[model samples]
Target: MSEVLLLLLLLLALGPGASALPKPSGQRQTGPQRNKLLLVSFDGFRWDYDQDVETPELDMISVRGVKAKYITPPMLTMTSPSHFTTITGRWVEDHEVVHNMMFDQKTNLKVPHKETLRRTEWWDTGATPLWITAQNQGLKVGSFHFPGGGAHYSGQPIQRHVFETPGFPDDNETEWRENLDTVLDWFSVEDFDLVTLYFGEPDNVGHQRGPDTPERKDIVRQIDRALGHLRRGIDARNLTHNLNVIVTSDHGMTTVKKRPLVDEIILNKYLPLLKLASFEILDYGGFGILTPRPGREAEVLESLAKVPNITAYSKSQMPYSFHLGRSQRLPPVVIQADLGFNLNSRLIVYVNKGDHGYHSGEMDMKTIFRAFGPDFRQNVVSQPFDSVHIYPLMCRLLQLQPAPHNGSEEVTRALLVQETDGASRLVSSLLLLVSFLFFFV
Candidate 1:
């Protein structure tokens, strides 16, 4: 009987059904940890939600879950790599997506592909996305308009959709509306173990008009309505008991106060003009950090730094405390703008309404994350966290092992079961006991 009791105790302690069993150390799982996850990312959300425009729908979701005021992004605040980091749990440099545009080192050419629809080498991602991982574990997965996830999961038993429009920034609203319709249709058809919805309008509008602008607010409202539809879908299917909804953005967008230094004419004249080795955006400016190819650093900086409205930085002189990567592909100098400055390329020179290829420090690069589901706690988390942590949090929700991510487990505290054993160390640097002591004491 004692042996049987010991076996039962082990089952209760480690098994998913062990909630009611007391730990030998006299503890229990924390509040509620999610079981299934639905992550929604709204591009170009500011980190400072308090200072940004009002978002009633977002606030409601936050009140029902945790809301982080700051979610630091990877080195390059571009959309493609940032989203890649979010799902793969790695930095952009580690994932091999240094920027929005992927260039071939040998040919010295750009590989062009549409945002979500492109499946070329330029768009190839290194980390396994949550959809693929979930499906591997027999969970049903679905995503609407999340970049990097484009149709990769399509025809694989998981329902994945993509929307791509040529020269889209000019007609973002129309495309977003059409994508919303598609998402609504998917929600209407079948029950999903997981679902993701992404909206690029806010990011697109914010890039052109700034995050707090009137147009940005309008975009937020439209996304809010779409989320409302999602909530109603939850009710229609009575999924509140099992479904977990997570909302977040890749990175925040900011407004450039100053003008661009490398205008179209200058860029066109200099691109093929310079018999240079390589060029890269180190941080957030033309001059802030520029790494020229080997012997070309001095000449490249001398030429590009001379431009007004640009700041240059040596590879060793970056401002913020971020460990980008240690690789041969890393540039020797990074360039950024002074406050309110942006870089102009051939794409932006002629357009009246323009938004492309910006890595500005002032571009309100903050993103948002809020979650509500069976596995979430009813509390507001206003601390700073990174979006890369979401990948592991989703894995925990589905009760599966996740690929390693760079973020600390403290970022995922809100996603844990109340009074549980502890967060897996691989997921966080925090000592669970220390966190508990700090919170309680």
Candidate 2:
């Protein structure tokens, strides 16, 4: 009877079954940690998206979970790099996923944004993402339509990954449900410990219809509906108790002024028009990377300095505050247009009504962050923070040893419940003492 009782106490101390068992002292797990985690990102969800829409689901979670006023993404706030930064806990410079597209300086060749995601050379440069890290530390993780989800890091595959279509699409409500179901199945049936799910939304609509337009509002409603379904799905699958959920975004959207309405930063308009043969221009909405041909650095700088409403810099000279200049993949010259403007090669027709890729300090570039579940505190709303801090938060959640990252575990400590092991450990120790007495004394 004493032995059976001691076994019961041991099981209780270790958590439901043995999945939450702590590793060695170096990788000591903390808190009454949850059994699993699910990270969801709705592309281009601005910090204030909940204000205008009836986001009952998001609002509900804020009260039941933890909410951040906002979180700043890294510089050149686009999709892939920012998402990678969230997972790796590194700034754009450290992770080296500087932009959406991949480019080779030697050949001046470019890969489309979608193709760039699948290319291993760009993603596996150095940092190991959460999927790789968690799996390396003995956890099963899945990625569903997330940026860098499909690529192999150092030739190692994600335990599970899904990205059926290219280009973040919108008219796929049914598919969204199917994907959520699949993830829930992974957690319940396949015993996955962590999964990252992504949805391309308001970001796509915002680009075509502008951030403040009615079409954008409709997309926001769609996002709320999706959130509602996820909430219900969690409860239905009995995962609300053990599954921690964090919903966030890559970056926010801002309106872009077209040529007729406002002056576009046309590179040719600047004096000493950068010769086509002497440079490689990668212009994406408000951000542009200019790779000057050898010996043409002086000419490129002079021409870019002449352009009004544009902040231009060489890779070595990029503003230190932005934390964006360290990547070897970055080009010779970089330019950022002032808000409400875009960098265009030529004053052409058809501009995206909305765009990101702005400097990190732009309020419009900030993103959303929401988290909840067993391990998180209730009804705590936090001040704005950088997204890089999220990776450390996740590492603590899983009790896994995090790879070298720039974020602080303390910065996100406020969001979690205080660790409570004193009573449990004491009772467990007493039980062991009694068992020893019964066995030998």
The most accurate candidate by TM-score is 2
CA RMSD, predictions in order: 7.6, 6.8
TM-score of every candidate relative to the true structure: 0.73, 0.87
Residue-level lDDT tens digits of model 2 in 1-441:
567766766666655533342432234343555368999999999888779878788889999999999999988699999999999999888999988888877776788887887888889878989899988878889999899988898889998898658543554888888888889899888879999998888798878889998888887887888888888888898888889999999999999877583566667666443453244553588888877767888777877787888888888987887788787878778888888788777555446899998887888888999999887878989999999999988988887788899998878876876443434464666777687777875
Across residues 84-186, which tens digit of lDDT does each residue of candidate 1 receive?
Answer: 7887777665665665655555455554435424654444444566677666766566777676666353334235555555565633555655565555455
Worst 10 contiguous positions by lDDT, candidate 1: 20-29
Off by over 4 Å in 1: 1-34, 49-54, 112-117, 151-159, 165-191, 258-294, 302-321, 327-333, 345-363, 415-441
Positional deviation of residue 134's Cα in model 2 after best superposition, in angstroms: 0.4
Candidate 2 is scored at a TM of 0.87
Q: Candidate 2 clashing pairs?
A: none
lDDT of each candidate versus the true structure? 0.57, 0.82
Off by over 4 Å in 2: 1-34, 259-261, 271-277, 347-350, 419-441
